[model samples]
Target: MSVDSDPDMFSSQTTVASNWSKDERSQKDTFNWAMEMMSHGQYLPLKSQASLNLEDLQYSTKMYYIRQARLACEIVCESIAPSQGIELLTQVYQSMKLKTAETKKKDAVTDTIISAYKKAEDYTTKVQILSLIVEKYSKSELLSFIEGLTIYKIDAARKYASTHGPGQYVTPPKITRLRLSKQKIHHFIEFISAPCYLQVVGFGSRHLKLSSGLTVKVPKVIRTMIASRLITAYNNYCKDNTILPPCRATQYKIIKACAASQLKSLHGLDNYISDGMESIDTLKKVVSNLGTKGLQTSKVSDLIQSLDTLKLHLKNEFRSHLSTESDCSQHCMHFALSEKGCEHTHSNICQPCDRMYQIRDEIQNVMTSNFSNIEIQEKEELEHDILVSTEKNLGLEGSFY
Candidate 1:
């Protein structure tokens, strides 16, 4: 019988049915009580509070309480139809009793839900609730929830690597070949932001499986960015410069700054060069048939050619040389004046410019060139004027003698 259709047993006591057949009564009683209690309207705030406060509990007990709470929630979810599940769950959840504690209330309840989610056997159910919980919690809480799930440990590791670098993490030593088969480049753009994807960027196995199930070969342009960041951070902070890795959260900032200009140009080049691999008409047909069982195949030369052009453009951009001083100031010109001064100017790179400058160079160094060898010529006219001014020695050297 449908849970909602059983109206004969209305009283709280009758819902347990003492005289009915044992098995039948047990099933009815359990289902009825579960439905009633689960539907109780007073526990929503309590359950939410419990999830918040669960984190501070001892690990073992914390795990137990969260499991019970999750089981209770899941049973309600599974037993009810999706159409009414949320409404009923919300109602019953309101009546549940919660352990009330002021301190760490938020963390405790979050911990409870996260622990329960970890032990949940139903993948679909787990994913659904976990996504909800993540959306509800703060970043720190969300990360905590992630830490509880073994599956997302990879993401955690990648986040650490982005800050601490690959050497600190157990990353593959190198990345050689790149395969780019995914239809959309937008996925790669998003991947760059994810911790797990960034971790495996330059080095290691060719095949990568994203949590979302879209697997693709790491393209060369992407790998270079990964390698450049890690290797530079390693060399500078770990050894040569003897400093901590660049400020936390700034690695991707560097990557984005370096890649932005390139992505724009790449779009233009792809639109221009991809004409021959397949006709536009055939290419359009294949795109329309993507992800279907009866899809047909064509040369796709036009599409592939466009993709290649994009890839090449990205490669060039990733490996593009940064010009240190594009517009030389008069001071720089003065510095570049004589052969000796010119050599000095060339050898002594502006600190800020050189730092990001070197990073860009290493990534694109594979087939790229360095900045043109020019002395920073200083404005002698200005310098001579300063020397000739009568107000030059404004300070007194006097009385000590």
Candidate 2:
């Protein structure tokens, strides 16, 4: 007969059966009370009552109830008193069963970690949890967690800074710095020993200064100096390793390609040169006008001096190219004469040589003497025009007055 039909037999079964019955009833009562408290938003009282009943509960049952109470308290704390809820959860976590299901244990651990992370007031606790995670978790998991934490902290900081306004100084929480340092260390360890160490070093050194400027509250001058030093060090490393060393020919080719792309036709060379000269003329006129108006001349003087230097450079380049082209033509002519078996002495100039020499002389005259005289004359004429215009303007203004 079934136990239900045999009441006498059930009663005589054993103390173990009776004890099991009592324990089951107690667990049901505790679960019902906890649920009722949670429904009524009595989270603090529920936590206390749950802790009291934990001693009476079986290990498995105790863990399940603790999880439920922790979740309820978290919701309450988030809406009302976060610190109190977190404190309650911490207590429940302490009492959690270690022998629980793997998934449940992981969930409990995660919840605890999250609680630790949210405790900004206690940076030490957060740092401890972060270190523990890094030490225990797989690299991929650690990286994922760190990345999320970094993004969250940065976003929170930005929001706080914006709300506080510019004049108000906002410093990052200590926990954030600790996490970032840990993350950087982890990244360095992971990448620095790899085959692509050079690439890693190149990237890190380049961005380290930028990251510091954006994330840290350092002065602009200091940041710039730090960045310069880092770049210099990276360049030195590249030089030492002969990794992608600079080639002057490659640089020249790149520059030539860029220039060629911008230039539509070789015939526009003279036009471009003339445009540059006209720009200089306009600058001179502006300076003269500024002087006539009795404005600042220091800036104008600096500009005029720079322009003179630029003009000198242009003249030098033109002279060098003229000399090079003339020498090239002479060499070609000489080669042709030798190939023809005509042994012409240097003193005995051929027709081609004579014409080339005359052309070279003309170029030399233009580069060395004619250009300088023309520039002097133009400057004098410009000065005269400026004085005349200034006098005319003064006369007109005087007549109006």
Candidate 3:
């Protein structure tokens, strides 16, 4: 009886194994057919059909499918940029995984494929692609996916090592103080270093506005001036070796104060003054250092003298030009006035009475010059004649008197 039961049990076990084998073969066949269709651009017919269980498909089938997709990508790439190929590779990688196992869990797998592709090139375009992925995908999923792809493809594997693999550049390397946290630091660098116009208010009570596309290397003199104001800011805010973080409205005030203080400290208070606005004075006081107080009086005096000289020269040139214009206009007006047909009337004048004033001024100046010289000559002759008469009277004594 025991021997008979054993044969029966063996038959049952064999039947179960046979059924499992059949299922496996069927999945493998389905995967093979899917891959062949993909190669021939014949996937349209199979897109919606759930004809096979991917989890049941043989591992060999999945590998061949991936290889075919990669080859197809390469063929397309030969005629275009590798980026186009990589994008296609990424899509195909996702589609294959979609057909295979857990759809939701494939994100990690797909991300890994993308990272592997990026590692293939250190090109700027590749780096840009990686940056986009980093922003779009979760960090852990991205790291894990790259790990898996690298296992079979050693170059990808090596590149993965460069980041997560051993002997890679340090994960979070030492950077400048400003770049302490990668994300925050990068943002700060972009913000502070961006080319934008600065609208400043408070230096010498003026709302000073200036646009700067200046780089890190500010001129020594300008740097010194700014440093002086920074020193004031440091003293006022009680910090050193750092500038105040910009905060919208407050930024303009702080910058203006700092700039004013620096200019006054390094050059002179008067040098930074603007007549245009009233806030600059308040800023100047805010940034002013008690210890480094007064502006250099002598320099201010010198600048004043230089300005005065320039003003005088400009005034003389202006007056001379006006005089020349007036004379020309006067001659033209006189000619017009003297004409018998001048009865056409001033109503026809284009530029108004300003031209009449100019003409009158020119005529007066000309008349004054000519009349003054003649009158002087006549007066001298009268004096000479009086002297001659006195001399004659003296010579003739009482008779002549």
Which model scores highest in lDDT? 2
In model 2, what is the error at residue 222, expressed in angstroms? 28
Candidate 2 per-residue C-alpha lDDT over 300-367 given as tens digits, one digit per residue, 9 for 90 to 100: 57545654554433322221212111234333333433345434343333343234234323323433
lDDT of every predicted structure (CA atoms): 0.40, 0.42, 0.39
Q: How high is the lDDT of residue 127 in model 2?
A: 46
lDDT of 1 by residue, 1-401 (tens): 75456666455446566545565644445554555676673333222223346666778777766765665675567467655766677666654422122222455766776677678786544654455354444455455436555546434434544555432423447966544444323333443444322322244334456679997664433332344544343334334335334433444544554232222232323332222212222323333333132222332343334434433322322212122232322214333332233432343443332332232233223112321221223223322322322111111000000
lDDT score of residue 1 within candidate 1? 72
Clashes of 1: 41
Off-target runs (Cα >4 Å) in candidate 1 are 1-24, 27-88, 91-158, 161-401
**Candidate 3: tens digits of C-alpha lDDT, residues 245-345:** 43333434444433322223312322211221122222222222211333345533443343344333221221122211123332233332344433222
lDDT of 1 at 24: 61
The count of backbone overlaps in candidate 2 is 0
Worst 10 residues of 1 by lDDT: 392-401
Q: Where is model 3 poorest over a 10-residue stretch in terms of lDDT?
A: 316-325
Each candidate's TM vs. the true structure? 0.14, 0.21, 0.15
